[model samples]
Target: MAHTTKLNTDLTGKTALVTGGTKGIGKAIADELAAAGARVIISARNAPSAESTHHFIAADLTNAQQASSLARQINDEFGGIDMLINNVGGLTTPGGGYSALTDKHWEDELQLNLIAAIRLDREFIPVMTARRNAVIIHISSIAARQALWNLNLAYAVSKSALNSYSKALATELASKGVRVLTVSPGATKTPPMEKFIADYAAAQNIPEESALAQLLQQTGGIPMGRMAEPEEVASLVHYLVSPAASYLTGSIYAIDGGALPVVS
Candidate 1:
């Protein structure tokens, strides 16, 4: 018998904060949450060139002072958020193995990917703990498990640290009303990914399609034979943070289309 189960994803009274929400996966998440009736607020270093429906705050979260100010502003303006999506991370270092990376490169990667989320969680976890049914999601990458040493060394290391931190935090907050989880997406079709492909193609003097194929081959290829759409990742996140996912916590959810060869 096929039984239909309706998911309670309604966020009519909830507020969400999505960092780096002006573009890519973060933007998609903000849009999806907004469509699901959440009051979404997005933060980035700069405002978007075009206007958007979601509230935008110019904040460089990599800076401790800026992160604190952003948190204070959100608490004052929105009375603390019900959902915190830590999506303000990226691969902002040079490629070509460990030697190509310097101390500054490692520091930058960790600051952007791991420390920023830690600071934000520190600011909002108290507020979330005080309230009932709060959710905190950390947007990670499959690179945490499968690293292309020449390309994403520093970035992958940072995400690996983030994964560990998320699990520990989730365990600590499990008894509290807050739910903390990590969402790891593999090779999603986002603006940054497209640009990465294009740049690779140009550098290798090959077509973009070939560059993409080579990159996929490096990652052992996706069994699904394609990259995930940003919306698809957003949909999974929506489910994880929704009321229907109340029992799910203290784990890493992979949206990688079976790209991971071994079971995690």
Candidate 2:
């Protein structure tokens, strides 16, 4: 038999560092963690655009030195991380086809989606290992399984690498008491999706609804016929960090509205 999670987990004195937590899914996760009584440090290249801040540390993750420095700052301020969420990532361009993308595009995509997380984790894990209890969550994308439509070659490849790294890290950390988990979200209702729908509508001179319909058909229609809200993905992350999910580790959870053709 299984049970459900409760809101009373009360992480009152715990500290967490959430990369890219300024907006979208990252912002949602930061809010959930804060509501459960944790003190969260949200980091981004600029001052957080959203109010995810109980505290904010600006850092550009594209450089490994900055990532290491940010990790050190977190250690100095919070003592050590109890939870770490690697959420800084995005598609580098709209070039939608492989040939249209250049070497620079691939490098940029990989830096943002895969390499940044690895750099930060290298700094974070050792700090957490000393504690004997901690959790790290990586936000991946559905392209990790099915390819991204057209010109997102680099983005897809980066996510695939991220998925592989996340699994390997999870296995290596379990015995040390740090749980690493990953979430892959498809067609989520983040700011980027809104822009995609709007732009496609403009390009085709169709209503946004129609454009979204055609877009869904081109990819694979979500059985639920709607994109997931950021909060919905955050809910799963919340549980994975909670004691309730202590037995779960080294797994990838896809929250894609049943868009994948096969069941895992």
Tens-digit lDDT track for model 1 on 124-180? 999999987999999999999988898999999999999999999999999999999
What are the TM-scores, per candidate, against the unseen true structure?
A: 0.96, 0.92
Tens-digit per-residue lDDT, 1-264, candidate 2 = 665544446677778888888888888888999988888889888887544446888899999889988988888877888998999998766646877877888888899999999998889888899986699999998877887657367788899999999999999999998999999998898887788789779988999999988878866799997899999998888888877777889999999999988878
Measured with C-alpha atoms, the lDDT of residue 205 in candidate 1 is: 100
Local accuracy by lDDT, each model: 0.94, 0.85
Clashing residue pairs found in predicted model 2: 96-151, 97-151
Best by TM-score: 1
Global lDDT of model 2? 0.85
Off-target runs (Cα >4 Å) in candidate 2 are: 1-8, 50-53, 149-151
Could you give me the TM-score of model 1 versus the true structure?
0.96
